[model samples]
Target: MQAFRHFKRVVTDWFLCGMFLATFLAWLFPRFGSSGGSMHAEYVINIGVFLVFFLHGINLSSEQIRHGLKNWRLHLMVQGFTFVVFPLLWLLGKSVLGTQIPALLMLGFLYLCALPSTISSSVALTGSAGGNVPAAILNASLSSVLGIFITPWLVSLVVGSGSDGIDLGATLLDLCALLLMPLVLGQLLRPWLGRFFARHKRYTNVMDKLVILLLVYAAFCNSMVSGMWQQQGSAVLLMALVGSGLLLALILWMTTRTARALKFSPADEIAAVFCASKKSLAAGAPMAALIFGAHPGLGLILLPIMIYHPLQLIVCSIMAEHYANRPAPQAADPALVSAR
Candidate 1:
């Protein structure tokens, strides 16, 4: 039992293991996870998505957002990197190296790029590194909310005729109805429900992971039925993993340099790099379901972010520890100092 517990700890440390297991299960039994599968996975996934966003709204503290609003420069820098610089980098890579990458993977990269920084991971890492935790919380939350509107427009602008002829106007309406409405409703009821969610945050996290896994399983199940894996095979997946790592490294370098060049304080720099460099799989998965729902290549397009998510967590974790060990800055933000 002790050995089993240790093994479970090791496996759970990298959450992507669960996703890979889901993909493997999908491959083995595609019919169970396919859109019209025996399990009726579509209905389950839809409900799961709604609940995930609703929980997000309840957990997000308006007071924290208000407190974090004072650092305009840091916020501007972080948001710019997330929304502007990351997408620009992807576009440039596509222009120069487009032919080298599979078309679907390129699309995946774009979606990954346009996504907002993840909320929990970004703030957690910042706090761990003794960075501006409030700023991280605000910027990450803001990014997720903004991406609800901006990501679709950005993808529609460049995706042009690729996403099963997605009608941007229709897609936007669906997202607002599916994602935004639940979020707003939850936020409105936060006064009553917030404490319950706070106490059971672990359960909400389990729900979030299960939803993402279901999406992955359904996506791969559909792709398997269409024989997408046969066409692309392991080679494409290997490229995606390698490419994700390189892209993450480049972004990390850029964020660090840009933050230093702007002369941001150490804590702010830590927050900027972590918040700007990370992308949200939680946001990306549902948005993809809405935007590219009809596309046959949905699995391939979902590949990069799936690959990028674990890679960023692993890499940023090391970076966070390094930052944590660094000597205190001569002058630190009072908020950050207090956090430590």
Candidate 2:
């Protein structure tokens, strides 16, 4: 009974559980949140996305940004892994397996590769693992901001004019209006609002989760209404899951090995590995909405990140625990130290 209770508690504690529930509800009642549904979910999600970014700006401290910028080498390593290496890996994977995997899943994997490192989870895991927390904060924050410009451009470049009628100009304008401008406005007003938000962070956190759930519900609803799931078999989802795992494993191996080769200290290595390895669902979902814009395959495009999210959390949590439990290196002997 105790073990069962613990299991239930753990499951509910994960935000992914809420996402699953939202997806399930969306499947059951597709019309409720479809593009032209009675609920008008698209408008709601747009507002929610704007609010999420605005609040994020208010929460971001200039002090932290300045502090985080101190480690250029660490920052370069992490960002290189995120933007350069991951996308290359996707291209290589697609070239090799393009015919075997579904097109939608391949696009999803490419989208996943282009996303930024997850801010919350990367920082949390880095701190848990006794990493350079400021570096994690800086890299994660920069990755997300850079992703606003890079993700769309990268996708459009590779997919030729951004598949599914995605106009780079219009999409960039919309992002500026809904996302970038709000964030800048919030930052401009941060002197007055920052303290309030700092005190009511739980409210902001709730809003973030609410926005994500709404987006997921609406995306899946649209897909279901269009019979996307009916057209694609369960094998696609399994392949996405398997692909997510492989992508994560490869990135993890690369980041850790590269960090070690660079001779990073233990703390910096921990930060580099964690920051370079995560993809942000929070950023990915909203960006997808803006990038895809009611495309029926939106749900399919989200599959890789959705699977990657929970997988990363589980794997990184284990890695964090391992780092936390490891013993500190022994000090050099006094004689050796003196001779040196």
Candidate 3:
């Protein structure tokens, strides 16, 4: 039993193991996850996704909201890094490397850059890293909300056929109805329900992981069924793997430097760095399905997101462990220790 516990700790410590397991399961059982298969998995997954955020709302305290909102500077830096800086870096890479990078990969890179920071993973990573949990929650939620308006507009600029390829208006409606509405409803009822969640936060986390797993499996299965890998040749796929890792390292370094440069508290710095550096697969995958559903290279676009998701998880897990084990400071944020 003790040996089993240590093995479990190691697997859970490397959280990316869950992501890889989900992908392998999807590949092994593609028919069940495929959209065209007998099962109508998306409908069930959507409901699960809704409940994930609804519970998120129930747990979000009024104090968290108030405190998070007060840190406008942190919010701006995070949003800017997610939307503006990431995209520009990709653009520079493409321009400098010009035509050497596959056009399909470039499109994928642009789409990945345009996405907001993730909601579930960013906060989870921050919490694990012993960061300011409330600030991470607020920034991530705000980024998702803002992406509803910003992502489509940015995609339109880059892709030139966003309107014909994707119904921007419909995309907005999906985000608001699916992600935002349930969240708002939960927040409204939190006064009565928050205590239940206070004691049951672990369940809330389980729900988050389940939703992510479903989405990742479904997206990869659909892409594989559509013969996504065959179209992109192994060389380009390899480049994407190497490039995604490099990009993440660059951003993680910058986030830390920016946090220090700006004189943020160690806690605030952790929150900002983790939240800013993550791209939202939850938002991006669905948005891609809607935007590029008809496009021939849909699977290619999803490739970077799939690769980056696990890469970020592994990298962040290392960082989270390092932060969690850091020596305690006299004035450290209480929430940081709460993670340990």
The TM-score, computed over Cα atoms with residue i paired to residue i, of candidate 3 is 0.81
Q: Please, what are the lDDT tens digits per residue for candidate 3 over residues 1-340?
A: 5444434555575335666787788768877877766656668677877787788678766686577888888988999899899988888988887588788788888888889898777888789888988999889888877887788778777766444456677767776777778878999999888898889888787777777676667776776777765666789888789889889999999999999999998789989999999987767765665555534465577678778876787677678877888988769778998998
Off by over 4 Å in 1: 1-11, 161-164, 330-340
User: What would you estimate as the lDDT of candidate 2?
Assistant: 0.90
Q: For candidate 2, write residues 225-282 as lDDT tens digits.
A: 9999999988998899999999999999999999999999999999999999999999
Point to the candidate with the largest lDDT: 2
Candidate 3: stretches off by over 4 Å: 1-18, 25-31, 124-130, 161-163, 294-297, 321-340
Selected candidate, larger TM-score, 1 vs 2:
2
lDDT of 3 at 53: 70
| lDDT (Cα atoms) of all candidates against the true structure | 0.87, 0.90, 0.78
Error of 2 at 196 (Å): 1.5
For residues 1-340, what per-residue lDDT tens digits would candidate 1 score against the true structure?
5444534544586457888898899889988878777978768888999999999999999998898899999999989988899889999999999999988899899999988899999999999999998889899999988998889888987876444566788888888888898899999999999999999999999888888888888888888888888888688989899989999999999999999999998999999999999999888888898888745688898999998887787778878878999987477689998999
Q: Sorted by TM-score, highest first, which candidate order results?
A: 2, 1, 3
Predict model 1's lDDT versus the native: 0.87
Find the number of clashing residue pairs for candidate 3: 0
